[model samples]
Target: MWPPRRSGGGDVKHCYARGHRDSGLVSGSSHVRSDMGDIGFKLKVLRRIGIIQPTSPARGLKAAKALRTWGPGFPSGVAATAARFPQQTAIHDDAGDITWGELKADIDRYTQALKDRGVGPGVSVAVLQRNHRYLVMTLVAVMQAGGRLLLLNTMASSSQLTELTKREGAELAVIDSEFLEVAKNIPRESIVLAWADDDAPDDLPTVASISADMPSDPHDKPEKSGQIIIFTSGTTGLPKGARREEPKDLKPLLAYFGAIPYRGNSTVVLAAPLFHSWGLINFGFGLSTAPTYVLRRKFSPEQVLKDIETYRARVLVVVPLMIQRLVDASSEAIEKRDVSSLEITASSGSALAGDLANHFMDLFTDSVYNFYGATETGWVTIASPEDLRAAPGTAGRPPWRTTVKILDENGKELPQGETGVIHVGNDMPFGGYTDGNSKSFADGLMHTGDLGYFDEDGRLFVAGRDDDMIISGGENVFPRELEDALIEHPAISDVVVTGVDDPDWGQALAAYVVVKDGQEIDADGVIAHAREHVARFAVPRKVTFLDELPRNPTGKVMKRELPDPA
Candidate 1:
């Protein structure tokens, strides 16, 4: 075990860190000395020390000084690795492989180009494109230049993008060539530049000329310097922009890297779209950890397996749906492919179906993990491979850094094994809503709208979203639990359960399904099949066959868009 150093003043030092063990038991907070537990003591200690003076090197620029131990113009942790392993593969796509050195060079060139474009600190640049090596480079350049980075979904309607550009007053948009037409919708004041791929840097003239200046240290950047702004589809209508700033305490995120056990010496496969927080964070953290990253523009079961074999990836990060899709894919190639190198994998964005989680563990022989977090709330809890083996549906205990409290509607903490809303926050919490009209992170905790509870053993189990709850025939139902049962049908490939406005039952359960190829199934057949697994009241009264379920760029089911069943 690595010995603990004196935690710089004002920082909370954890007592114990959850390390890797083969037992599949998830770890919890270290023991606190002053009566309180580890996280509880740290909370009290941080409250005791007021915000540090900006000029003090011990506090003001801690992140910056950490960077100086490396090189110049390298703001991200990944840049340091390039100097050590220049030839190793950094990113793999149809475009070809990008070496660590090549990625660093591309970022430097782009950083200079962005400077020429009148972009600098406090300026927010929106990027609208799919996942690719170029997107990764652009993100690093924005952070390197002290500019706020905003990710724009290419799938958004043109009108939506236009309003967002105006709302945030985006200074410029770096977009793919295919999105140039959509970029025209932005007001005349904002500039748009096409992302240059292989050709000559023709747009360099448009970028403003500026000297290469690195922050004297990571801590030198303004505390309010917004690093990334991710827009979430609002339940009501438009999207909400969730801005994540650089935290004064980097220990939380850095701990995530260590806890997951996928840093340096490993290749992290990125199968999810970069537009989502999960994909974006996975990419950024990989850079900090200096692990090789493999990218796929879109998820395809066959392509994913092939990439894993080709890259010899040791770590994989993806959503539960993607995991299910890959697992459902033909196994003739699966058995033949060499996946024995994989040591750690993470599933996030949604809950892992209990059965699917079991199937994955059985197939992987216990190297799969599940992390619970949201775009709004950073890292909450994690169910490592060991933890999941112990409790199949639990989201695991809170991360070594964050604190969680399950509270009922009355805002009081609920007793163990009782259901309530899950609230999480810590020193690493990022303030929210930079759009003026957005949600602010007022309290120390982020109220996750998810309904869940903690077991006697402190394992978190998610029930469903507070909004997704369905009241049918006066009985409460969570679509997620019912949907889990629907996927068990042999004929069903993918399914979504939603509530349809009903006259008699207040609301009725409805199912939208995609059946396997050459498979035949109908509404009654699915309802009858699901009835055997779940209560009759929870079964869908109506099932509509669809080619696919509507999802946002992040692969989350867009329940608001599902058509009403006839």
Candidate 2:
């Protein structure tokens, strides 16, 4: 939604909302706030974002009734968006585009098709595909049909996929056409194709094909909303399934709106894989605001710039790695495109290094939002551009309705400027691991499994993972501080510090450095750079130069893949 236009010769599309206004309050959220200021805050946010407008009262009633039938979640949100703004563009993928009305109809048909195939309530369904139109449809339709959703990483191997399918008890496996060969190993009788190309097998069963021949089946609303499971990054161990409970209030929505200035009915280019928590969260926002999402099955730095120019997008959801690639491609390809339409580059899913954030903002617009969180707990802290400029590498402050604490090993609170464990309490709390494992907590706050300290200005700075801390010669060395120092070198582009066993010191530092292109640097220079910036004990005893550090799908360094110290 845009500002009101003058009475001139220009066409303006009006973005409006109805549901909360139907409930008499502008926020349509059920809250027991006694303070009038608290009530007024949400009302202003809704109105500024075009969610509260002068519209028909009956339309608001219909929007409210649509959510009542589907229950609250992505399914209900999409249904409500369709009820209020059916003509609004909801999705724009590589194949084509679809309106809210068309998307809702397709989802409803597919929901019936799924229910007929015994994908009833509590049944588990696994989805494996890149970001695409059908993939989004199948995910929402499964939720509407009352099936527990297991989102699979597209980069997983045949063995991992097979193991995950059997381990999660996913009765059905919906795969893209390219991965049909890998699907053979999933060991599921109800294997369905999410999408297929021209050369796909003739007997392939797709969601479209299945829905085309399916009968109209009417069913009552589900007694309970289905659970959504996002697997952990298998860096530490085997991937564990983590489910999120159904939201109790509009706190999550209000919290996001309060921090990130998201507009209604805008265009967003999602470069991040939709299977991950970060991408899926943005997808949820797109549904609520009815943004025209531009999705590509694969990610390319150059292609992403092109998409931004083509779509004139307002927001871009991605991991930090994509920003690095964009910067790397700046001279070669990205500089040619007019990508100034981007207003917010909301990065999550992996660590957003301080240097990378500033470099990106310098090259592009000053719109980098460094989101610090995990798959278990969403958006712990968001560093705005102002926060990043004021204090680089700082995770900024917690958003609304969020609590963050730095606690010592004994579960006691740590004062500011003291590094300790990070515990958080927010609307997007974890629903425990599916394997019955859960994160440790203290005083109603979930332990984030991270080490960090708060600055004098209340900014959070994550030192590193708790396990990544090294005790070399009885001196504690945090790799993040050293890595941040080394990345500032003019010749170095990236670096990662880790602990290595040493006979001299109980444990030693090993730094993997990625030198900038056309620059020459060896172990001596790298060691000198480290020694100048960090303590002698924190300096790397061994330096290994690499073209690039290996990373997982979500841009996390796969430390296990690093070679043994030479």
Candidate 3:
């Protein structure tokens, strides 16, 4: 262990930190056990999921000690994983492969460098980089130094970044050199380049430069763990920064393991944006599972096929749009790769349309798991491949230890099969937005701002955004229902239904569709399909054909960019 430095503040521990109780750090025992049922369940789930394997008694013991030394949260995950699996491949990026030991070495060096820059408990550090090894190191470093991590979206505008950096009060901003122009106006003094250019000045700070000068001694264990902040989906407006700390209860881990079969140490190609909560969840989960992550700065459907074959990846993590693009890729492109090693293909970040899910499953294995939740609500539900196959578009039931309720505007609980706003209760609840804004909560459950209902099998079927509910021809209608129906048509590969102004009806539905390749279907066919699938009033009045739909990074439709109905 590195020589201990004094914590600036006295050792003030949060009662919620499970590291003290069950990390096996405090006890120095080979077998990590806890009296608390939650922590015990955590270990059980980890072991059950092949995360806490009996590799070597000595290594396991070392891992426990490392966790104790690093305190709770992301820091401990890095340290403990390194101790247990030093030679194991941890990260695979464009920079090539890095072992767990190598990653820990880099993170260990930067943790001190980060602390020297006045980053610790309650301190804030903003990161603006894509998915890469540098991004991973910076994440662990900030957390090790006990600083709250503000994850900025790569798609944010310069003005947005400037306003956000200033409003969030970020003292330091770490950015990729490629994004230098975008981050130029961000109010920050300590700007560290994440990915620098070859011709960059030697004096300028970069992750590689500071990591090279890493101090031999590790920073002192933080008195408290750091927090993670992700932004809300800004499809409609400016995204708000939603913050959260690691859940005090380990039960949430069980819920994750129960829903998604991400085995420990498996190779996975994660194409989802790391700045989002969906990607962040797997990133955090990998701390214990220690999966080999194959990352690319930018996603490419063609490159993903090659990456999977090259790495023999067992799991493929993606957003729905990526999946759609993959499915749309030429038959020759997909036929060339040996992606048979894939056991799980998980989808998150946005809704995975039922028909799209079915088409994806038809091509690949029936191993799709579409996660449904928002930044404000932590993992509200998970739909397994079976759930998707049987129920099609139904969001699977809440996993272990999570509760979901349908509530009316007055906060009254609605019965099953009744449409209402979605409210969620989970161990990892949202800590509200960084600007002191928060989601509506009812009796301690947070509102999801979505309208959905429970089916006979207790599955959730989201109608659409609660605010998107429209009245057409004096009849209440939901665009999602119509879009869902239209997407099922074989000729149509993609569709989006929205409320458009109409002289005939105060509001009418308008659909923008992308016809499947080699198909000769026309607007009349689409209208006929919708008419057959949905109610008369819910049918889209206007059908506009498009080559493709505008989408955000996470596969969410950018409805704001849609053209007004002709």
Candidate 4:
């Protein structure tokens, strides 16, 4: 069980007051003490979340400083880290390792080049590239140049890219040469290629030429921090751009990083796509922690393990699918590699199936942590290894100063163990979508569009998306419960459950399955297996075998693309 919460007392106030003083944010004068009551409450919350240690004054001071300095955005953090750790290795990619000082130089050069192209505050610059050092540099440079960063998914089609860039009003697109054709819809002059080869097309200019003559001095900071417009997965339809501003308060940021145990001098191998929120958050954390970041343009499970062993990486940031791939790697291959250096494995982006979670922890020590959140609401809950071991499917408890509630269609709160739309209230909920539409917000909580319930232990368990719910013969069903049961079968490699049209039942469950190699399972066998674990109504009425399920770049199953049973 988790530790019990401490009672309210003057000791909490004293701890926060000392923390504030040590941080150099506040003086130890009577004037500061007059407001210690409110500051103390905030500190108490942070303490309860395990961000601030009760006995470690140095850790408290360091966390306080990190929170205080997080507001000026990416450029400021990069510059600060460079000044503090000039010789430290900041990023390692296919090209070579780059130090903090070298990283800042590259960012400054690109910032100057972008400024020369009239990119500044309010200007939207779309970046279309795979994971690499150039991509990282471009993101920082755009933020430094005071331009709104429009992150484009590399897996999107030409038409999808055209529509998104046009709708988002992007004036310039910095892309890899390979993706230049896909981004042809953008004006020729507006497109600048970054990762071009010797035989690159002659029509467009390259980022190399643009920055070759530019100075490495800092570019002017924007009056207001530029926004980062991250698009939704667009699994069902056109993706929406979720807008975020540089966070002003660092309390929530501190709480999250502190709870996750990301420390200074740590080495991290990031496997998730840079465009997604999970990868982006880890990038932000990297800047503050000044970790040695190992980057790869594409994900290969074996390569990820190799990088961990090569770099002695302590943490691996990934999505759930990446974890599955790692687990699926042959036992012989996994045994030959030395992954003993790994201390933590952070997973988000999608649901971490309970079976996958347990298998991963069993293979690699009990250091796996599953975080639950969406692009719109930020992070809401985190399931530690112990949480997964105790309650296999729980999403864990909310962090400090964050609240989670289950609400019905009428906006009334639901009791524990009753599934409803999950609503979250946090310090850093997204401002709104770029298109002016917003999710339902009542009181202070924002609707997450996820259907879930809290167990008796206050752990969150997501059933499925509210929109993904199916009414079959007047009995509502969620695909997650059935999918979870089906995945437990040894023959199942990967599986996704969806509701298809049915005559007798209003809608019927269909399972798209990818069977494991050397294993055989037919549609009838799948249904029979599910029947043993779940109710008859919950069993999939049809099962279609496939080489693999269609997935977006972030590894989410594309339900709309699943084929109908013959």
Candidate 5:
């Protein structure tokens, strides 16, 4: 029954069968076996893709032990990895490399220092820093000391930070030296530790100095797992903290481990900000896999390519904006590096447009994977290279043990090929927002606020956000389709399509385009090009040229910031 209950007791058949019920498709025990067979086939595909080594009894035993010891928390996992792979290279940053043994010692020292300052259970600690070895170590130390972590977005304004920190009841703020002004409103004596070793402002102290003489032996483990408060991207409104509880079942993550090509003893270049979910999750996976994570304080496309060659990195973790930047970099600059060592380029954080996907794959081979999910929903789908080749812009099918459905405004499931709101069901839904508000939930599925449809083959394709859809002349239009078509133009470098007020059409399509250097294209030419690829109603009625589109740190377009048409 139910394929012998592989990792979790939740019936896989029941999960996926719910989607088929809308279409009146029959599902039974045979479907469960087919799902299990797919997983087994994926395991073999992973080996062929170089994501996992060929199985051996010793290797299996070691992996099983690692999984059992990690327990879904970074503090305990780091400690376990140090004891097992003491000499393995754990981190490689601008400063130098550090082994698991060295990292553990550093974490222990920081834990001791934080404990002396009364940082323990129920204590909220805010961290505002760039990506570096110090920031990574501080996260582990704070949790190890039994303190909750409030990950601050570096791009937030000082007023925004002050408001969020107050809302989250943060008592201590560990900040980078460059961002000292952002924490000015906080009390100086409340343990404002500098994340980097740079000279602190007159009122602050560096974390390095505080832990310099601390003993690195026998750190105390937290009585319970510490909560991690990650904020929403805040594009639509004020950011809210999405509190994460300690994972009880790791079964949901097994889908990602199967679909993504992360291997042990490999080099992973983390270009995405560590403050975001995509980066933080990969960082946690690195702890147990013992991969050498290459950290950078800032992201630069040129630097990313060079790091791949310099470190001979196997995986490059990034967002869609970073991918666009990599492709935008001069061909001469990109061609000089020997980046053949990279096997998998994992992209998430925002929608990966079809043209951008094809361009990246053409340059780097068929190694690009687009992951679709939200901060609250975790991962919903993964588009493999084959999926992209087939559907051009599909978000791909659901991973193992996950269910997805498209429902209309009436909350009724829509048939295939019909656009509706996307709802996803998984074993691990978010615990809830810290502000006592929850997203729309129905039948145990979390509403994603995105509108999309499923093709006959069951592959999902995301339209735009539900609110972003424009009702022009009674024909529903999504900006994503128009944007994807516009990006294929050779002269256009980047583009964002928005719905602007139009009395004649209810809401007309307006496009903001960034033309490539040394290329000139007028609004009429762009409109003419778009009409050839997209429907007439989907074509933009007006086009505005700009140097670049405004985006959040996670690479999502700040649509609210875009200028309205005159």
Candidate 6:
């Protein structure tokens, strides 16, 4: 069951019922006292589940004393975890399984190889590899050695990789053999480390003997160190690097690890690319919990089910397109597969509608969790099954430690029930954009460009992007509301709503649709169906059908490339 919304939006409460009270209050006086006791009990439960915290910072000093500590120069996360949980499985890749101990050894060797190649602190190393164990090894080694990591997409062309390499001013480029052709484009000035398929060289300097006796530096602050430069999906223009400033404190990481519901020993099917924040965070989050990760180089509906069944993956990050594909594959595929292992399923990176939320909840029962977040913002709010059941489109109120506000173009905070731009403030906000002196943190708030409004019921419903709104006949139309209605049709597989230029209306609503397999839907029929589902003005004035919608690697719809009909 979902918990009650907090005073400020975005505070999520996690509670699991243990047992019910047996004794019934006999007198009104007792009932009043019992109600007070119940409120106190719920407050304690909220604290335990990380929904609230003590105002007295040092109140938990005794408990904090018992927490595990990591030294500054910790070689790798695998090594650290190995010391804590040696027998536990650390990684499960196509190459094979590696325990925490074994993974640490690989990290040690990789660190030496990096050191041998003159890669030290302050240097940038670009990694372009599929989601394999090597990627983990590289990250561990680079971070352990106090270096910066720049993740590049394996699907990027040779020319694209070369440009990115130059942009980052990389000191080295590591690539899997499958993308060796692209690696060839990298400047010869940068060393190329290639792995032949999954069989990486054990002979590499990764296992070299370092001054281990050199009392491992307790505070290994390298010249320049931290996870910076997460690239955005170029839905508008060229991708920009979102630079992150490392927090001197680990409170946010600790808060996230504690707040996020992670079932231990569960298997997580990773379909998104690690180069993306969604995938990288999944990796970090999985590592924080030490869950089993079943990696996939790319997403295929068939493969998703197969991997879920094969590895008994209990959790996975999914986009809207993937959800539609998996649903279309077969409802039976979901039922027949041993998805009983699943406890939590999170969907993000796009707006999810009530109909789709209902469909998923009906299929998976209570496992579906709608997560609203962005690459810029880590995790803003999470809509639980109970929230979906109560208010389908409401992206659950923010987390316990987060704050959000909806504001109009005039910089005025909008009242409840009004749609406007969404701004957020969290403990772990990203630093800013790279390559320029621009800053997103203006007036102490992260402007989420996304337009949404809070309901009187205290739930936030995302409308669409502020820039994506279409003005038709002098009235504004949000694509998400219209898209939500259009997607309800059985014949529609996927769709994107955008504004196209118009002489009379200044701008008109246009829809680019991908019809379901073996089904035919024309522009007229699509618009007609929408007319019944939504306002007439919100219905598309034009429609273009394509075999598939143009999407970035992360599966986000590219509305800019929406083509006009001949």
Q: How close is candidate 2 to the true structure, as a TM-score?
A: 0.91
Q: What is the lDDT of residue 19 in candidate 5?
A: 29
- Best-to-worst order by lDDT is 3, 2, 4, 5, 1, 6
Model 1 misplacement above 4 A: 1-74, 83-87, 187-226, 234-236, 437-444
**Against the true structure, what is each candidate's TM-score?**
0.81, 0.91, 0.88, 0.88, 0.89, 0.81
Which candidate has the highest TM-score of all? 2
TM-score of 4: 0.88
- The residue pairs that clash in candidate 4, if any, are none
- How good is model 5 by TM-score? 0.89
**Candidate 1 lDDT by residue in tens digits, 91-126:** 887678988777777667767667667667888898
> How far in Å is the alpha carbon of 553 misplaced in model 1?
3.2
Tell me the alpha-carbon RMSD of every candidate. Answer: 9.8, 9.8, 10.9, 8.3, 6.8, 8.6
lDDT of each: 0.66, 0.77, 0.77, 0.76, 0.76, 0.63
lDDT per residue for candidate 4 within 1-566, as digits (tens), equals 11111111111011111113122222112233334654775565445433344434554454445345445467766776676567889888877899988888888998889888988888999988887888888888888777889998888889999999889889999998888778868888898997886677888887878888788976655675678989899888888999876667565566466447666667899888889988988887566666789988889888998998888888899998899899999887687778888878988998887578889878876778888898889877887888888888767767655666667787876543356777777667587999899878754588888877655555667778887888777667778878888888999989888888889887989888999999999888998888887655677888889999888877788777878864
Candidate 2 Cα misplacement greater than 4 A, ranges: 1-34, 214-219
Error at 298, model 5, angstroms: 1.1
Per model, how many backbone clashes are there?
12, 1, 0, 0, 0, 9
Q: By TM-score, how accurate is candidate 3? A: 0.88
lDDT of 6 by residue, 1-566 (tens): 11122211233232211111223221111232366654564455445433244433343442232123332122433444455555667666676787876666666666766676787876788887777777777766777666767877555667767777788788887767567667777664464444454454443222222323223222333455545467777776666677654444444454344334655556788777777776776676455344667776667777777777787777877765566667677766676776666666667667775477777767654666777788777766667767778877767766544667666676676654456667776666576666774435433567887777655555667777777877777666777777787788889988778877878788878888889888888888998888777665677778888899878776787655667742
lDDT tens digits, residue span 82-146, model 5: 76667878887777899988888888898898888888987899999888888888788887877
- What lDDT score goes with residue 159 in model 1? 83
* Model 1 TM-score on a 0 to 1 scale: 0.81
Model 2 alpha-carbon miss at residue 436, Å: 1.1
